[model samples]
Target: MSAAAVPEWLAAEVAALSGAARAGRLPHALLIHEAPGAGGDWLAHFAAQLALCERAAEAPCGSCTACRRVLAWQHPDLTRVAPLEDSRQIRIEQLRDLAAELALTSHAGGYKVGILTPATR
Candidate 1:
């Protein structure tokens, strides 16, 4: 989604994240909390796009190949962690695997982003 498409309620948070990214001061990890349908997942993906965008200067341009890949959930550098099928909670093995993946070098030689959804689970 384009920056303009971000919900107005989330705009300030997005701007802060963007500024941090541009300044090279973004945290190594972030926690995004949301109510049921609050677009938390979208914001998380946007954060990943900001870090993985090919165009660093205009990151999350929301149109670059990297951004497109992210939007499609096809980016090599983006790893999504969620509960297994029929499971209500993420298994420890899944988190271990996530750790292993993050330990490896990024495929694009840029940032590697892992998003853990339903963190409360």
Candidate 2:
């Protein structure tokens, strides 16, 4: 991916998170709150890729195998949660599923991202 595709602020946050992950000081969960168009989902995806990227250099190197899978939405480690098509609000069951997923270790020994869009309650 090109630099222009990522915003400056997000790039910096990704760098910081990458350092924490490499140093084994990253948190188990991160709660991100933002407006509809604030790019929260994109940011979460970026973090997941960065965590799983084999050649992560303070950022996700999109050319890596892990990065490719992540970009393709086929990474086994990345989990995205959103409201169901038939529902307007996030259900408790969704959060429960996410909790179960995060309870286990990452497949790639990296972070397992749970991106909850417009968190409910």
The TM-score, computed over Cα atoms with residue i paired to residue i, of candidate 1 is 0.96
Poorest 10 consecutive residues by lDDT, candidate 1: 1-10
Off by over 4 Å in 2: 1-4, 56-59
Candidate 1 has an lDDT of 0.91
After aligning candidate 1 to the native by TM-score, how far in Å is the CA of 121 from where it should be?
3.0
Model 1 residue 8 lDDT? 93
Please provide, for model 2 over 1-57, each residue's C-alpha lDDT reduced to its tens digit, 9 standing for 90 to 100: 445678775777666776787786766666767676777777777777767787756
lDDT of 1 by residue, 1-121 (tens): 5766888999889999999999998789998988978989888988999999999988888889999999888999999999989898988999999999999999999999999988995
TM-score of each candidate structure, all chains considered together: 0.96, 0.77
Model 2 quality (TM-score) = 0.77
